[model samples]
Target: MAAVAILLLVWQGVSVAGLVPRYMLPAPVEVLQAFWKDRGALWNNSLITLQEAGLGLVCGVSLGFLFALVMDASPLLYRAFYPILVITQTIPTVAIAPLLVLWFGYEMTPKVILIVLVTFFPVTVGLLDGFRSVDRDAVGLLRSMGASKKQIFWYLKAPSALPQFFSGLRIAAAYSVVGAVISEWLGGFGGLGVYMTRVKSAFAFEKMFAVIFLISAVSLLLMALVNGLERLAMPYRKVKQEEREDSQ
Candidate 1:
């Protein structure tokens, strides 16, 4: 709320001062009005983008976790693939977006694929690091008890890795929306990216700002949801000594 208030004050000041032309940068009130006027269309397009982003996030995270698990289980696989994964991220997505569009056409499939590509690397690296960073002594103890590899991974490695997995999840959630938008910008039927292109073409600066605001809101909501899930998944982690003392 404080940030919004500050932004509104700056926006209103800029509008009153006529620093730049109104068409170039509309006032917050004007953007809000435009948002209301285009609410139905904006909502529909946003929903489409959300679906693509959500599905892509799911696919990317699932694949990344599985790959991380495989790499964690096999040192040879990690040695073979880690550098390749690093190299993949070195190529700019902007450079690849056009090619993706060219190959996949302006369909949801391309957008979802782009989102998956963008989101996967962070998750894989994060989870891999988490898995590897597990306490060696704990694994040794488990092994002494005749715990199999699968049992050790399930009972020890995975639990220890949750924090890092959630860290990567937060990063991936932010990227997912951005990936969807960028892919849509290259080519898409409906989404904030397409809506932005249309508004820019029409010189509707206020509407564009409104769409931008909506995109930020969506990203923020996603991050908050991930945080909530993290808390739910690791409730015991939050029960610190202070909490124990208070309960006693």
Candidate 2:
């Protein structure tokens, strides 16, 4: 918090010093004022982006989880699909966004698809790595005890994968929101992206800064929510950390 305050102070000082033109770099105060003045419009647009992000996260995380499960179940599937997953990510999203817009039209589908593309890779990779890292000895023990594959997965692999899954989710949360906004940049009816475009076109730099800051705050909030979920999903982890702190 102190570091952020210092940074803001430096920004305000620089603007006041006229190091850059006011139009090019508005002061924090100007941005804040614009934020307050345009709060209604911003809120409405923000909800749309948030909805797009939420739905995208759901779809992306679901698909990624399913993909990881299939890959884990069969080494052949892993080998076949793993490369395709990696290759898909190599394509720049900016390039893909326009293509998706063209195919899906200027609706929410393309934006959702864009977010899913940005989000799924991390989750797939994380879950795959986690599943693979499971102890073969433990797996063998379960097999020797006449445990079915489903039982082994439920008791062993799924729990092991959760931490990594949550890690991926955190990354995906931020990416999901940003991806929606970027898709809106190409073409959309209303969203933070559309709002940003309008402000930029009208030379409303203060509002531009306002929207940028709002987007960042929203992203941070989403990440924080993920962290809370991680804590919930792994209560033992939190307890262990607390024990360590007490001992220290």
Candidate 3:
């Protein structure tokens, strides 16, 4: 709330001072009005983008987790694939967007694929690090007790990795929305990206700002959802009442 208030104050100040042309950078009031006027269209486009982002996030994270597990189970596979994964990140999404459009055309497939590409790397790396960074002492103790590898991984490594995995998930959730929008910008039938393009072409600065605000809101909401899931999945990580009292 404080941050938002500060931004609004600055925006209003700039508008009143006439620092930029009204058409170039519309006042917050104008943007709010534009948002209200186009509420239904904005909502429809936003829903399309959200659906693509959600699907991509689910697919990316699931595949990433499975890949991480495979890598954890096999040193050779890790050595063979880790560098390729790193190289994939070097190729900018903007460059890939056009090519994806060419390959998949202007449809949800390309956007979803782009989202998956953008989201998967962080998740894979985070999970792999979390799994590899598991307490060796704990592993040794489990081994001494003749615990199977599956048992050790299930009880120790997987649990230990949850916090880190969710950290990556939060990042991926934010990126997924951006990735979908970017892909849609390159080529798409319906989405905020396409709406943004239309608004820009028509020189509707207020509507552009409105769409941007909506996109930011969507990203923040997804991040918050991921944080909630993290808390739910790792309840044991929460500070116990006794621990809180002792710390105090």
What TM-score would each prediction reach against the true structure?
0.95, 0.97, 0.95
* Regions more than 4 Å wrong, model 3: 240-248
Q: What is the C-alpha RMSD of each candidate to the true structure, in Å?
A: 2.2, 1.0, 1.6
For candidate 1, list the clashing residue pairs, or say none.
none
Query: Model 3: per-residue lDDT, tens digit, 1-248?
Result: 99989999899889979999899889999999999999999999999999999999999998889889999999999999999988888899999999999998898888888888888888999899899889999999999999999999999999989878998999999999999889888889999999999999999999999999999999999999998998889887676745888899
Give the range where candidate 1 is weakest over 10 consecutive residues by summed lDDT: 235-244
Question: Which residue pairs show backbone clashes in model 2?
Answer: none
Evaluate residue 229 in candidate 1 and report its C-alpha lDDT on the 0 to 100 scale. Answer: 98
- The best candidate by lDDT is 2
Instruction: List residue ranges in candidate 2 displaced over 4 A.
Output: none
Per-candidate clashes, comma-separated: 0, 0, 0
**Which clashing pairs does model 3 show?**
none
Clashes of 1: 0
**lDDT (Cα, tens digit) per residue for candidate 1, span 1-248:** 99989979998899979998998889888999999999999999999889989999999999898889889888999999899988878888888988989998988888888888888888998899898899999999999999999999899989988999999999999999988988898888898899999999999999999999999999999999999999899988778746988999
lDDT of 2 by residue, 90-154 (tens): 98988999899999999899999999998998999999988988999999999999999999999
Q: Tell me how far the alpha carbon of residue 83 in candidate 3 is from the true structure, in angstroms, after superposition.
A: 0.8
Judging by lDDT, tell me the better candidate of 2 and 3: 2
